[model samples]
Target: MSAFLRSCRRIFWALAAFSGMSNLLMLTGSFFMLQVYDRVLPGRSIPTLIALMALATVLYLFQGGLDLVRSRISGRVGRYLDEKLSIRVFDALVRMPLKTRADGDGLQPLRDLDQVRGFLSGGGPTALFDLPWMPIYLGVCFLFHFWIGVTALVGAVVLVGITMLTETRTRGPARASSRLAVSRSALAIEGRRNAEVLQAMGMRRQAALRWREVNVKYLAANERASDVANGLGGISKVFRSILQSLVLAVGAVLVINQESTAGIIIAGSILTARALAPVELAIANWKGFVAARQSGQRLDQLLKILPCEEERLALPAPGETLVVEHLYVGAPNAERPTLSEVSFALRRGQAVGIIGPSGSGKSTLARALVGVWPSVRGRIRLDNAALEHWASDALGRHIGYLPQDVELFEGSIAANIARFDVHATAAAVLEASRAAGAHDLILSLPDAYSTKIGEGGMTLSAGQRQRIGLARAFYGKPFLVVLDEPSSNLDSEGEEALTQAILNVRCRGGIVVVVAHRPKALEGVDHVLVLGDGRVQSFGKREEVLNRVLRNPVPLKVVAEGPGGGR
Candidate 1:
């Protein structure tokens, strides 16, 4: 939250103003009592008493007005702060290394992010709010009465100690619970995400079991923590009751001796309880505070990641090349590299087709080329310099990457393709869509490109969605276009359409790289890089690689040209 400290000034002052109003209001109540006792009872005059009561009511109204103003200012500023924080978090995730972004087994790190964010959002603010109250409460108490203030001060210490102890004991359990909950949440999300797959495979029962396992563990940990908190609650009540009884008893004895007035006793008791309120809240939310702190720490860690030099480059001004040399990437705690000693180069107007079977690291290689996998060894040069030397903003402008799964937003097709970049004009959008073979399909829709696509493009056919994905890739006419299985689910007609779009990119003098298992889709490509066992098996002209593979009986198939392209 240190990152947010600068903005805290606005929020803090707003809260300070509100807190001051609250204290003033409380003091007003005591002052009204003081007036009633000193004047109203001594002189039983109705007009005088009514006038004084009216003045007290005005004071309360003023305090309430101040409180309303403070709340308005603080609430608005707090929302802005939250937006800033969320933006920073999203930018960090986008810039983080591919490995760091993923949990394990090559899933999107976004899944983990969503889980962590859910846990943090609900439980993160307690500590921050609690910290602010500490000084504010103490300052008010000290101003009220030093002797009572000292007692309040001691109570604060005791309250903090109890909270700390609860946090110390419950922190581990809370963390375990949050993690389990996240796991279950992820599974539940996955279950829904792949509901069709689960239904097809008749694995609904298995999915249910997996979900139950995680949730049961989560629920058990929650119960255990709840029991501990309940025990602490009982003990805290007994202790507080005893302390309050002693204070009241002492005040009564002092009153009997005429050392203190009934008014003083009442004010002192109320002050003590008010001072203790924050402490009680702190203890009650000890686990929540810890959870929030951990979340903030995690958030901070994520935000502090320094982007590599590649992510800092300016956009390519046309005529750029995408190059790689002796690239290698290994998984954490695994000796076997995912992409081993892989190397290739692609210049403007060049098309390089990368073919590999499942689990052969094609996706990893594609990500490395985009500078998303930064932990890999070896060189990745864009234009004439290291890819790492370019800023992400620059590289992003010049490189368009299309993953196997196209994640479309819940917006119009044109909006999704343009990513809501206000600069993208209608003509530009149409050009991109036509070039991607998505224009025909989009124009057939009632609203054309303006038609809304449901979440993840659920409303569009797989082929149509893939076309939209391709259109998104071409929206900026990026120098390098990386397509991972662009035609995986396309029919013959869709494949032909996709092939034409690829050729269109090549004709535009842009570098096109297709990561594919079905090499037949890469017909007429200039080059082919075949990967096996995480290493490059062949790197040369498509014909040369095919010849070598055929001679070695390595199962080669010639790419067949689509309609309109000569065979």
Candidate 2:
């Protein structure tokens, strides 16, 4: 609220100044017109006539200048607020809990914010807060004659009421239309994202039909809302015309009775329009306010969500081992736990391979180890201390993770490799690349390490992308290295390279836990854990786990080779 107020202050002050100057100037002009009619024309001095003309011209010029300044400053203030709000919202999103982000519906905040830009740019009510003369003009009318002022004010209110009534009748349809439009927009985005797949499946026509259905639904609602709004606009126009006619009639009568000067009557007529302008606009843009209100509530809800300390990123610690004790974790409002009664410890320099079928909770365990699942009902410790005790930055430095689906930024190869450490020398990157078996491939490219990878490394083959991901894990010599499905999308050579990279991390006295499906990749690991249905089926030395697997042929084919070289 403080921020919002501060953002509005400049515009408010500018509006106040503009309103005051315009009113004073207009009043001065009214007095001048009266002097010209009642004094100048009746054999007044030439000097007096010149003086009145000069003063009126100066007042009009000053009014124009004040209005110009107000408009410019108000626009600048609105833009500044737009930038500030966008930055704050983005920062909040980055800090939001993973679960909350995933469960939330859409990117409507961004869209609504865009609409807010239009509203602000339209210089709506926010820009009129300082216009005190609007009321003062009416007060002047009342001072001249109470009944006249009362009639005008009442007419203004009734005009506004009629406009608002019409708007209200269509509000529901307007909101429904907005929702339908957003839905169609989301579908369009989804279709564009999967255009390749849709083409492959020959479903483009079907997709187009679905898109047409959504479009028709959205258009129908929009047309209904538009029709109702136009009707309300017509009503508002009639009321305004009636109000203006009454003001003119009253002003003419006053002029004839000599109760008010002709100049004052004319000024009063203009004031009538000025006074009702904001009311008319306020009624017309009630929907903008409604939308803003809804958007604010959503942002407030997101801000109000409690932080989950466990999943939050923490600083690295100079710890040797990571441990979990009977950890239990599940999504909010879920009846069954994703993982429960799971206990494990990773020692310094240990290599542990976790094997499981799809949906066996192996990936969840990996995520838990990285502190992404903070609501788990158990303890995770680093060097015998609570995981939360460590700072997020420090913790990240001590751990390197390669998710099953690789994520790469759109940048040159060197840029991605040096992301965590900007000062990483070429030699260090080359060494890491070699370990991951990507150095030769990178060198084969026209630009070598300087080669620009497309967004998410889309330009690279799947296997090459996986190698780059693996190479990033080796870039930093973290205490713990976690690789989930490192070889799932890799070919024979890529798998060989990934296995060697794992060996390299292990050789450096770093703990490695890899979720693997291939037998060759698990070779020579210090320990093996077989998981099924969120429970540990077996956990022991590599040889022991292999013996059990041999008894009952492993679910994933495990081709073995005596402790030797390549696959």
Task: Report model 1's TM-score to 2 decimal places.
Answer: 0.80
What local lDDT score does residue 427 receive in model 1, on the 0 to 100 scale? 87
RMSD from true fold, candidate 2 = 4.5
Scored by CA lDDT, what does every candidate get? 0.69, 0.71
lDDT of model 1 at position 34: 51
Candidate 1 C-alpha lDDT tens digits along 390-494: 766666777888887778889999998886788879888888888877787898988998899987788888878888888898888888888888777777777
lDDT for predicted candidate 2 compared with the true structure:
0.71
Best by lDDT: 2
Lowest summed-lDDT stretch of 10 residues in model 1?
558-567
| lDDT, candidate 1, at 209 | 99
